[model samples]
Target: MSAGKGLFVSFEGIDGSGKSTQARLLAEALRADGREVVLTREPGGSPGAEEIRALVLQGDPERWSAETELLLFTAARRDHLERTIQPALACGATVICDRFADSTRMYQGLSRGDLRRAVDTLHDLMIGVEPDLTILIDMDPAAALSRAKARATAEERFEDFGIGLQEKMRAGFLALAEEFATRFAVIDGNRAPEAVAEDVLAALKARA
Candidate 1:
Protein backbone atom coordinates (compact mmCIF):
# COMPACT_ATOMS: atom_id res chain seq x y z
CA MET A 1 0.00 0.00 0.00
CA SER A 2 3.00 2.26 0.33
CA ALA A 3 3.22 4.58 -2.66
CA GLY A 4 7.00 4.31 -2.59
CA LYS A 5 9.88 2.86 -0.62
CA GLY A 6 9.18 5.02 2.42
CA LEU A 7 6.08 5.00 4.62
CA PHE A 8 3.58 7.82 4.35
CA VAL A 9 1.73 8.65 7.55
CA SER A 10 -0.86 11.36 8.14
CA PHE A 11 -2.32 12.72 11.37
CA GLU A 12 -5.96 13.76 11.40
CA GLY A 13 -8.36 15.18 13.98
CA ILE A 14 -10.44 18.22 14.79
CA ASP A 15 -8.56 21.44 15.50
CA GLY A 16 -6.64 21.37 18.84
CA SER A 17 -6.81 17.62 19.07
CA GLY A 18 -3.04 17.48 19.55
CA LYS A 19 -2.51 15.55 16.34
CA SER A 20 0.14 18.03 15.26
CA THR A 21 2.14 17.48 18.44
CA GLN A 22 1.84 13.76 18.00
CA ALA A 23 3.03 14.01 14.38
CA ARG A 24 6.18 15.77 15.53
CA LEU A 25 6.73 13.24 18.30
CA LEU A 26 6.42 10.32 15.91
CA ALA A 27 8.84 11.94 13.47
CA GLU A 28 11.38 12.41 16.22
CA ALA A 29 11.00 8.81 17.30
CA LEU A 30 11.44 7.57 13.76
CA ARG A 31 14.57 9.69 13.30
CA ALA A 32 16.00 8.41 16.56
CA ASP A 33 15.65 4.95 15.12
CA GLY A 34 17.68 6.07 12.08
CA ARG A 35 14.81 6.65 9.69
CA GLU A 36 14.84 9.73 7.49
CA VAL A 37 11.65 11.64 8.30
CA VAL A 38 10.00 14.38 6.29
CA LEU A 39 7.46 16.03 8.55
CA THR A 40 5.12 18.41 6.73
CA ARG A 41 1.60 19.88 6.81
CA GLU A 42 -1.30 20.24 4.44
CA PRO A 43 -2.37 23.45 2.70
CA GLY A 44 1.22 24.59 3.07
CA GLY A 45 3.71 21.83 2.63
CA SER A 46 5.23 23.38 -0.48
CA PRO A 47 5.99 26.98 -1.44
CA GLY A 48 2.95 27.44 -3.65
CA ALA A 49 0.72 25.62 -1.22
CA GLU A 50 1.92 27.81 1.62
CA GLU A 51 0.76 30.84 -0.31
CA ILE A 52 -2.66 29.26 -0.70
CA ARG A 53 -2.66 28.37 2.98
CA ALA A 54 -2.59 32.04 3.93
CA LEU A 55 -5.60 32.74 1.77
CA VAL A 56 -7.63 29.83 3.09
CA LEU A 57 -6.71 29.92 6.77
CA GLN A 58 -6.50 33.60 7.63
CA GLY A 59 -9.65 35.12 6.23
CA ASP A 60 -13.11 35.38 7.77
CA PRO A 61 -15.11 32.19 8.04
CA GLU A 62 -17.41 33.48 5.33
CA ARG A 63 -14.63 34.83 3.16
CA TRP A 64 -14.64 31.74 0.96
CA SER A 65 -17.65 29.58 0.55
CA ALA A 66 -17.32 25.87 1.18
CA GLU A 67 -17.14 25.21 -2.54
CA THR A 68 -14.37 27.73 -3.00
CA GLU A 69 -12.48 26.35 -0.02
CA LEU A 70 -12.67 22.90 -1.55
CA LEU A 71 -11.08 24.04 -4.78
CA LEU A 72 -8.40 26.00 -2.98
CA PHE A 73 -7.52 23.15 -0.66
CA THR A 74 -7.37 20.67 -3.52
CA ALA A 75 -5.05 22.97 -5.40
CA ALA A 76 -2.77 23.29 -2.38
CA ARG A 77 -2.79 19.55 -1.91
CA ARG A 78 -1.85 18.97 -5.53
CA ASP A 79 1.10 21.27 -5.17
CA HIS A 80 2.03 19.66 -1.87
CA LEU A 81 2.00 16.21 -3.41
CA GLU A 82 4.05 17.19 -6.42
CA ARG A 83 6.63 19.34 -4.62
CA THR A 84 6.89 17.76 -1.18
CA ILE A 85 5.12 14.49 -0.35
CA GLN A 86 5.81 12.35 -3.42
CA PRO A 87 9.45 13.25 -3.72
CA ALA A 88 10.08 12.50 -0.04
CA LEU A 89 8.44 9.09 -0.31
CA ALA A 90 10.16 8.37 -3.60
CA CYS A 91 13.48 8.94 -1.86
CA GLY A 92 12.61 6.52 0.98
CA ALA A 93 11.92 9.11 3.65
CA THR A 94 9.06 8.66 6.05
CA VAL A 95 6.62 11.46 5.27
CA ILE A 96 4.71 12.55 8.36
CA CYS A 97 1.97 14.91 7.32
CA ASP A 98 0.04 16.87 9.96
CA ARG A 99 -3.15 16.99 7.95
CA PHE A 100 -4.16 15.41 4.66
CA ALA A 101 -7.18 14.99 2.43
CA ASP A 102 -9.33 13.62 5.22
CA SER A 103 -9.39 17.09 6.68
CA THR A 104 -10.82 18.25 3.39
CA ARG A 105 -13.29 15.40 3.50
CA MET A 106 -14.57 16.62 6.85
CA TYR A 107 -14.17 20.38 6.65
CA GLN A 108 -14.97 21.11 3.04
CA GLY A 109 -16.84 17.94 2.21
CA LEU A 110 -19.21 17.89 5.17
CA SER A 111 -18.87 21.15 7.04
CA ARG A 112 -20.86 23.69 5.06
CA GLY A 113 -22.25 21.32 2.47
CA ASP A 114 -22.28 17.77 1.15
CA LEU A 115 -19.38 18.12 -1.24
CA ARG A 116 -17.97 14.71 -0.45
CA ARG A 117 -18.51 13.59 -4.02
CA ALA A 118 -16.65 16.56 -5.38
CA VAL A 119 -13.82 16.07 -2.92
CA ASP A 120 -13.48 12.43 -3.91
CA THR A 121 -13.69 13.15 -7.62
CA LEU A 122 -11.01 15.80 -7.48
CA HIS A 123 -8.84 13.56 -5.31
CA ASP A 124 -9.07 10.69 -7.76
CA LEU A 125 -8.46 12.93 -10.73
CA MET A 126 -5.67 15.15 -9.43
CA ILE A 127 -4.25 13.42 -6.34
CA GLY A 128 -4.62 9.69 -6.32
CA VAL A 129 -2.28 8.91 -3.48
CA GLU A 130 -3.36 7.96 0.05
CA PRO A 131 -1.34 7.71 3.18
CA ASP A 132 -0.07 4.24 4.02
CA LEU A 133 -1.15 4.87 7.60
CA THR A 134 -3.30 7.56 9.19
CA ILE A 135 -3.33 8.33 12.90
CA LEU A 136 -6.52 9.94 14.16
CA ILE A 137 -6.30 11.64 17.53
CA ASP A 138 -9.75 11.52 19.06
CA MET A 139 -10.98 13.81 21.85
CA ASP A 140 -14.01 15.74 23.06
CA PRO A 141 -14.95 18.72 20.92
CA ALA A 142 -15.34 21.09 23.87
CA ALA A 143 -11.91 20.37 25.29
CA ALA A 144 -10.28 20.46 21.90
CA LEU A 145 -11.93 23.75 21.05
CA SER A 146 -10.65 25.33 24.24
CA ARG A 147 -7.13 24.20 23.43
CA ALA A 148 -7.41 25.46 19.89
CA LYS A 149 -8.67 28.88 20.94
CA ALA A 150 -5.81 29.19 23.41
CA ARG A 151 -3.31 29.13 20.57
CA ALA A 152 -4.83 32.33 19.12
CA THR A 153 -2.81 32.01 15.93
CA ALA A 154 -3.49 33.99 12.74
CA GLU A 155 -4.85 30.80 11.24
CA GLU A 156 -7.80 30.95 13.63
CA ARG A 157 -10.44 31.12 10.94
CA PHE A 158 -11.37 27.50 11.42
CA GLU A 159 -11.33 27.90 15.17
CA ASP A 160 -13.56 30.92 14.85
CA PHE A 161 -16.35 28.64 13.72
CA GLY A 162 -16.68 27.76 17.43
CA ILE A 163 -17.65 24.61 19.28
CA GLY A 164 -20.48 23.80 16.92
CA LEU A 165 -18.07 23.20 14.07
CA GLN A 166 -15.69 21.31 16.30
CA GLU A 167 -18.52 19.11 17.51
CA LYS A 168 -19.58 18.34 13.98
CA MET A 169 -16.00 17.79 12.90
CA ARG A 170 -15.29 15.37 15.74
CA ALA A 171 -18.22 13.22 14.78
CA GLY A 172 -17.35 13.40 11.11
CA PHE A 173 -13.76 12.41 11.81
CA LEU A 174 -14.89 9.39 13.84
CA ALA A 175 -17.08 8.34 10.98
CA LEU A 176 -14.19 8.83 8.58
CA ALA A 177 -12.02 6.55 10.73
CA GLU A 178 -14.63 3.88 10.28
CA GLU A 179 -14.92 4.50 6.57
CA PHE A 180 -11.15 4.17 6.13
CA ALA A 181 -10.64 1.70 8.95
CA THR A 182 -8.03 -0.29 7.10
CA ARG A 183 -5.51 2.56 7.11
CA PHE A 184 -6.57 4.32 10.31
CA ALA A 185 -5.40 4.04 13.90
CA VAL A 186 -7.67 5.91 16.29
CA ILE A 187 -5.85 7.11 19.40
CA ASP A 188 -7.30 8.87 22.41
CA GLY A 189 -6.09 12.45 22.84
CA ASN A 190 -7.41 13.07 26.35
CA ARG A 191 -4.15 12.42 28.12
CA ALA A 192 -0.91 14.35 28.55
CA PRO A 193 1.11 15.02 25.42
CA GLU A 194 3.80 12.49 26.36
CA ALA A 195 1.15 9.97 27.12
CA VAL A 196 -0.57 10.70 23.84
CA ALA A 197 2.76 10.47 22.07
CA GLU A 198 3.26 7.05 23.65
CA ASP A 199 -0.01 5.89 22.13
CA VAL A 200 0.83 7.46 18.77
CA LEU A 201 4.19 5.68 18.70
CA ALA A 202 2.52 2.46 19.69
CA ALA A 203 0.04 2.83 16.88
CA LEU A 204 2.85 3.33 14.37
CA LYS A 205 4.66 0.25 15.70
CA ALA A 206 1.46 -1.73 15.55
CA ARG A 207 0.94 -0.70 11.94
CA ALA A 208 4.52 -1.69 11.12
Candidate 2:
Protein backbone atom coordinates (compact mmCIF):
# COMPACT_ATOMS: atom_id res chain seq x y z
CA MET A 1 0.00 0.00 0.00
CA SER A 2 1.08 3.57 -0.60
CA ALA A 3 1.30 6.34 1.95
CA GLY A 4 -2.24 7.34 1.06
CA LYS A 5 -3.42 3.71 1.05
CA GLY A 6 -4.37 3.65 -2.60
CA LEU A 7 -6.11 0.60 -4.01
CA PHE A 8 -5.04 -1.10 -7.24
CA VAL A 9 -7.65 -3.00 -9.21
CA SER A 10 -7.46 -4.82 -12.50
CA PHE A 11 -10.08 -6.36 -14.81
CA GLU A 12 -9.41 -9.47 -16.86
CA GLY A 13 -11.22 -12.01 -19.05
CA ILE A 14 -11.43 -13.24 -22.62
CA ASP A 15 -11.60 -10.62 -25.32
CA GLY A 16 -14.92 -8.75 -25.42
CA SER A 17 -15.99 -10.15 -22.10
CA GLY A 18 -17.07 -6.64 -21.03
CA LYS A 19 -14.22 -6.33 -18.52
CA SER A 20 -13.20 -3.04 -20.10
CA THR A 21 -16.66 -1.60 -19.70
CA GLN A 22 -16.80 -2.77 -16.11
CA ALA A 23 -13.44 -1.20 -15.41
CA ARG A 24 -14.64 2.06 -16.84
CA LEU A 25 -17.87 1.94 -14.90
CA LEU A 26 -16.05 1.17 -11.68
CA ALA A 27 -13.75 4.12 -12.24
CA GLU A 28 -16.71 6.37 -12.90
CA ALA A 29 -18.48 5.13 -9.80
CA LEU A 30 -15.42 5.74 -7.67
CA ARG A 31 -15.03 9.22 -9.09
CA ALA A 32 -18.69 9.95 -8.32
CA ASP A 33 -17.94 9.00 -4.73
CA GLY A 34 -15.18 11.63 -4.70
CA ARG A 35 -12.33 9.14 -4.83
CA GLU A 36 -9.36 9.81 -7.06
CA VAL A 37 -9.46 7.29 -9.92
CA VAL A 38 -6.94 6.54 -12.62
CA LEU A 39 -8.22 4.47 -15.52
CA THR A 40 -5.59 2.76 -17.65
CA ARG A 41 -5.04 -0.27 -19.88
CA GLU A 42 -2.28 -2.79 -20.23
CA PRO A 43 0.29 -2.95 -23.00
CA GLY A 44 -0.51 0.70 -23.68
CA GLY A 45 -0.78 2.79 -20.55
CA SER A 46 2.44 4.79 -20.86
CA PRO A 47 4.02 6.30 -23.96
CA GLY A 48 6.58 3.55 -24.43
CA ALA A 49 4.06 0.89 -23.59
CA GLU A 50 1.59 2.36 -26.07
CA GLU A 51 4.22 2.10 -28.78
CA ILE A 52 4.84 -1.50 -27.82
CA ARG A 53 1.07 -2.13 -27.79
CA ALA A 54 0.89 -1.43 -31.51
CA LEU A 55 3.72 -3.82 -32.19
CA VAL A 56 2.11 -6.65 -30.21
CA LEU A 57 -1.60 -6.10 -30.80
CA GLN A 58 -1.73 -5.19 -34.47
CA GLY A 59 -0.62 -7.11 -37.59
CA ASP A 60 -0.81 -10.88 -38.00
CA PRO A 61 -1.36 -13.24 -35.12
CA GLU A 62 2.00 -14.84 -35.82
CA ARG A 63 3.80 -11.57 -36.20
CA TRP A 64 5.87 -12.64 -33.19
CA SER A 65 6.49 -15.97 -31.59
CA ALA A 66 4.83 -16.66 -28.25
CA GLU A 67 8.14 -16.38 -26.42
CA THR A 68 8.89 -13.09 -28.13
CA GLU A 69 5.48 -11.75 -27.40
CA LEU A 70 5.93 -12.63 -23.74
CA LEU A 71 9.12 -10.61 -23.62
CA LEU A 72 7.52 -7.65 -25.32
CA PHE A 73 4.54 -7.72 -23.01
CA THR A 74 6.76 -7.93 -19.95
CA ALA A 75 8.72 -4.96 -21.13
CA ALA A 76 5.60 -2.92 -21.71
CA ARG A 77 4.27 -3.93 -18.32
CA ARG A 78 7.48 -2.81 -16.61
CA ASP A 79 7.26 0.59 -18.21
CA HIS A 80 3.57 0.83 -17.41
CA LEU A 81 4.21 -0.04 -13.79
CA GLU A 82 7.02 2.47 -13.39
CA ARG A 83 5.40 5.35 -15.24
CA THR A 84 1.61 4.99 -14.79
CA ILE A 85 0.63 2.54 -12.07
CA GLN A 86 3.21 3.32 -9.39
CA PRO A 87 2.71 7.05 -9.65
CA ALA A 88 -1.06 6.83 -9.27
CA LEU A 89 -0.74 4.49 -6.31
CA ALA A 90 1.79 6.76 -4.70
CA CYS A 91 -0.65 9.63 -5.03
CA GLY A 92 -3.44 7.70 -3.32
CA ALA A 93 -5.50 7.26 -6.49
CA THR A 94 -7.54 4.18 -7.28
CA VAL A 95 -6.09 2.57 -10.40
CA ILE A 96 -8.52 0.59 -12.50
CA CYS A 97 -6.74 -1.18 -15.30
CA ASP A 98 -8.53 -2.87 -18.20
CA ARG A 99 -6.08 -5.77 -18.38
CA PHE A 100 -2.82 -6.78 -16.76
CA ALA A 101 -0.25 -9.56 -16.33
CA ASP A 102 -2.92 -12.24 -16.10
CA SER A 103 -3.77 -11.61 -19.72
CA THR A 104 -0.13 -12.27 -20.58
CA ARG A 105 -0.28 -15.42 -18.51
CA MET A 106 -3.16 -16.63 -20.67
CA TYR A 107 -2.23 -15.35 -24.12
CA GLN A 108 1.46 -16.12 -24.22
CA GLY A 109 1.84 -18.50 -21.31
CA LEU A 110 -1.03 -20.96 -21.78
CA SER A 111 -2.85 -20.38 -25.05
CA ARG A 112 0.18 -19.75 -27.19
CA GLY A 113 2.58 -22.20 -25.60
CA ASP A 114 3.66 -23.94 -22.42
CA LEU A 115 5.33 -20.91 -20.93
CA ARG A 116 3.50 -20.71 -17.64
CA ARG A 117 6.61 -21.21 -15.56
CA ALA A 118 8.52 -18.70 -17.61
CA VAL A 119 5.71 -16.18 -17.24
CA ASP A 120 5.61 -16.63 -13.50
CA THR A 121 9.35 -16.40 -13.19
CA LEU A 122 9.54 -13.28 -15.29
CA HIS A 123 6.70 -11.72 -13.37
CA ASP A 124 8.29 -12.40 -10.01
CA LEU A 125 11.61 -11.09 -11.20
CA MET A 126 10.67 -8.08 -13.33
CA ILE A 127 7.20 -7.12 -12.13
CA GLY A 128 6.68 -8.37 -8.62
CA VAL A 129 3.31 -6.73 -8.15
CA GLU A 130 -0.27 -7.97 -8.51
CA PRO A 131 -3.50 -6.08 -8.37
CA ASP A 132 -5.06 -5.74 -4.92
CA LEU A 133 -8.23 -6.98 -6.62
CA THR A 134 -8.71 -8.66 -9.97
CA ILE A 135 -12.22 -8.85 -11.40
CA LEU A 136 -12.63 -11.45 -14.14
CA ILE A 137 -15.74 -11.14 -16.30
CA ASP A 138 -16.71 -14.68 -17.18
CA MET A 139 -18.85 -15.29 -20.28
CA ASP A 140 -19.51 -17.69 -23.14
CA PRO A 141 -16.65 -17.84 -25.59
CA ALA A 142 -18.69 -17.76 -28.78
CA ALA A 143 -20.70 -14.77 -27.64
CA ALA A 144 -17.64 -12.87 -26.48
CA LEU A 145 -15.78 -13.66 -29.67
CA SER A 146 -18.69 -12.44 -31.73
CA ARG A 147 -18.73 -9.19 -29.81
CA ALA A 148 -14.96 -8.89 -30.21
CA LYS A 149 -15.04 -9.43 -33.94
CA ALA A 150 -17.97 -7.08 -34.35
CA ARG A 151 -15.67 -4.24 -33.45
CA ALA A 152 -13.45 -4.93 -36.49
CA THR A 153 -10.50 -3.10 -35.00
CA ALA A 154 -6.82 -3.41 -35.96
CA GLU A 155 -6.21 -4.95 -32.52
CA GLU A 156 -7.83 -8.07 -33.92
CA ARG A 157 -4.63 -10.07 -34.09
CA PHE A 158 -5.59 -12.20 -31.12
CA GLU A 159 -9.29 -12.13 -32.03
CA ASP A 160 -8.42 -13.40 -35.48
CA PHE A 161 -7.35 -16.64 -33.84
CA GLY A 162 -11.08 -17.35 -33.83
CA ILE A 163 -13.40 -19.18 -31.46
CA GLY A 164 -11.02 -21.98 -30.59
CA LEU A 165 -8.60 -19.55 -29.01
CA GLN A 166 -11.45 -17.73 -27.33
CA GLU A 167 -12.70 -20.96 -25.77
CA LYS A 168 -9.26 -21.83 -24.56
CA MET A 169 -8.79 -18.35 -23.13
CA ARG A 170 -12.12 -18.48 -21.31
CA ALA A 171 -11.27 -21.76 -19.62
CA GLY A 172 -7.78 -20.57 -18.87
CA PHE A 173 -9.08 -17.38 -17.29
CA LEU A 174 -11.47 -19.32 -15.08
CA ALA A 175 -8.65 -21.56 -13.97
CA LEU A 176 -6.52 -18.54 -13.30
CA ALA A 177 -9.22 -17.10 -11.06
CA GLU A 178 -9.09 -20.24 -8.98
CA GLU A 179 -5.33 -20.25 -8.98
CA PHE A 180 -5.31 -16.74 -7.52
CA ALA A 181 -8.55 -16.97 -5.62
CA THR A 182 -7.53 -14.64 -2.81
CA ARG A 183 -7.30 -11.64 -5.10
CA PHE A 184 -9.71 -12.76 -7.81
CA ALA A 185 -13.42 -12.21 -8.26
CA VAL A 186 -15.38 -14.04 -10.94
CA ILE A 187 -18.42 -12.16 -12.34
CA ASP A 188 -20.83 -13.48 -14.97
CA GLY A 189 -20.66 -11.19 -17.98
CA ASN A 190 -23.51 -12.66 -19.99
CA ARG A 191 -25.93 -9.93 -18.95
CA ALA A 192 -26.27 -6.28 -19.85
CA PRO A 193 -23.34 -3.94 -19.25
CA GLU A 194 -25.18 -2.13 -16.47
CA ALA A 195 -25.88 -5.39 -14.64
CA VAL A 196 -22.29 -6.45 -14.99
CA ALA A 197 -21.17 -3.10 -13.60
CA GLU A 198 -23.45 -3.58 -10.61
CA ASP A 199 -21.89 -6.93 -9.82
CA VAL A 200 -18.46 -5.41 -10.23
CA LEU A 201 -19.31 -2.78 -7.65
CA ALA A 202 -20.63 -5.46 -5.33
CA ALA A 203 -17.46 -7.44 -5.73
CA LEU A 204 -15.39 -4.41 -4.83
CA LYS A 205 -17.49 -3.79 -1.78
CA ALA A 206 -17.13 -7.41 -0.74
CA ARG A 207 -13.40 -7.20 -1.13
CA ALA A 208 -13.32 -3.99 0.81
Candidate 2 per-residue C-alpha lDDT over 1-208 given as tens digits, one digit per residue, 9 for 90 to 100: 4213689999999998988888999999999999999999998899999999999999988899999999999999999999999889888889999999999999999999999999999999999889999999999999999999999888999999999999999999999999999999999999999999999999999986
Candidate 1, residue 127: the lDDT equals 93
Which stretches of candidate 2 lie above 4 Å from their native place? Answer: 1-4
TM-score of every candidate relative to the true structure: 0.98, 0.98
Clashing residue pairs found in predicted model 1: none
Lowest-lDDT window of 10 residues in candidate 1?
1-10
lDDT digits (tens) for residues 1-208 of candidate 1 = 5577889999999999999999999999999999999999988999999999999999788899999999999999999999999898889899999999999999999998999999999999999999999999999999999999899899999999999999999999999999999999999999999999998888888887
Off by over 4 Å in 1: none
RMSD of each: 0.7, 1.3
Query: Can you list the residue pairs that collide in candidate 2?
Result: none
* TM-score of candidate 1 to 2 decimals: 0.98
